[model samples]
Target: MKLIRYGEPGHERIGVQINEVNYDVSAFGGDYDESFFASNGLARLDEFVKANAGNLIAIAEEERIAAPFTRPSKIVCIGLNYKDHAEETGATIPAEPIIFMKSTTALAGPNDQVMIPRNSKKTDWEVEFGIVIGKKASYVDESEALNYVAGYVLHNDVSEREFQIERGGTWDKGKGCDTFAPMGPVLTTADEIPDINQVGLWLKVNGKLYQNGNTSNLIFSVPFIVSYVSQFMTLLPGDVISTGTPAGVGLGFNPPIYLQAGDIIELGADYLGTQRQEVIAFQKN
Candidate 1:
């Protein structure tokens, strides 16, 4: 199922896509958050959809589409997980995953504008595949990791190069800016995808193609990341694990390129859906 939430920024209603039309599931009484997915809510959601098949309300054409889930407990990111990307940045491949976190406040709907923080000029775009955990997972085995995944979504890991590399700290500062993580047009359940590893993923800035790559190029695959991350930190339902970006990032360019105001970023994965975000400079009151 392509589970979705749609409406204004903070008031999205839970829904699912059927025959390309959104079927309202708000009557199920909760946004698609951690609690909902953890308590076997997806099964209940499926039942509801089946029972109310013909009665479901069709979402209006004007309503906005928000991130599929609300309030995820964590947004963990893997850095330099792709071989081409690691080589482009001139960084050695890590023995293990390079993990980082983005604040939940950074989360926004797929089409939301990416607000460049005041005085910032290095904002960048990273198109990645995000994993949504289905249940509490700790000390999970790589072989069993995919079993705990509820679905996948398209994520833009917006970054600030100077703040990330020259500011003398973790990547969080460059990553956690508001609207930096534009999540989805929809969250596709695991059953919808047969092979998660080979999806075609790419991104564009303005109208030119920038990052063009496939998940098949990932050095450390999704299951490895989930199992590896869980050994140290427990992963809760609705927690997001972004599987890192591929090559062709602005940082990987000859002279390097960065986002400025009025830039448009668009990205998508094979089955997860597509999203577009406009970049706007921040203005203080």
Candidate 2:
């Protein structure tokens, strides 16, 4: 099922998309968040859809689409997991996955304007597949990791290269800016996608192709990442695990190409839906 949230930024209502038409499911009685995922809420939602198949309200065309889920406990990201991306960044294949965290405040609607942080000159984009955890997982085995996943979403891991690299700090410095992580048109359940590792993902800036790659190139794979991450820290329900990006990022270019005011970016993956963001300059208060 294609689960969604639509409305203003902080007041979005639960929705479900079927047969390409969106229907309001706010009657289901709760927001999509950590508690919902931890309690097998998807199954309940499935039942609700089945019982109210023809009675669900059709959402108005003007309503805005927000990120599919509420603010997660955290957003964990894996870097250099893609062989091509690792090679492009001139880094060796890591013996294990490289993990980082993006501040929860960075979450924004899929089609919202991307804010170029104040004093920023090296903002960039990364098209990646994201995992939504279903249950609390700690020290999980790779073989059992898939059982703890709720769904997947398309994510643009926007970055600031100078703050990430030249500033002499962790990548999180450049990655956690507000609106840097614009996710979803919808969150697709894991059952809907048969093989998560074989999907194709791509993105473009100003109508020009910048990232065109597939999950097949991931060096560590999803199961390994989830299991590996659980060993050190507990992964709470509704937390996002961005699986990293493939090559063709601005940082991978000869001279590099960063985002500027008025630039339009579009990106998507099969089954995960698409998103478009218009770029604008940051304004100081």
Q: What TM-score do all the candidates reach, one by one?
A: 0.98, 0.98
Considering every candidate listed, which one attains the maximal lDDT? 2
C-alpha lDDT of residue 89 in model 2: 86
Query: What stretches of model 2 exceed 4 Å from their correct place?
Result: none
Compose the digit string of candidate 1's lDDT tens values, residues 30-63: 8788888889988999998998889999999789
lDDT scores for all predictions? 0.91, 0.94
Clashing pairs in 2: none
Native-to-model Cα distance after best TM-score fit, residue 195 in candidate 1, in Å: 0.3
> Against the true structure, candidate 2 has what lDDT?
0.94
> Per-residue alpha-carbon lDDT of model 2 for 1-285, expressed as tens digits?
989999998789999999778899999999999989988999999999999989999999778999999999999999998999999989898888999999999998889889999999999999999999999999999999999999999999999999998898688999999999999988999999989978999999999998899998998889999999999899999999999999999999989899999999999998998999999999663
Runs of candidate 1 with Cα error greater than 4 angstroms are none
Worst 10 residues of 1 by lDDT: 276-285
**Global lDDT of model 1:** 0.91
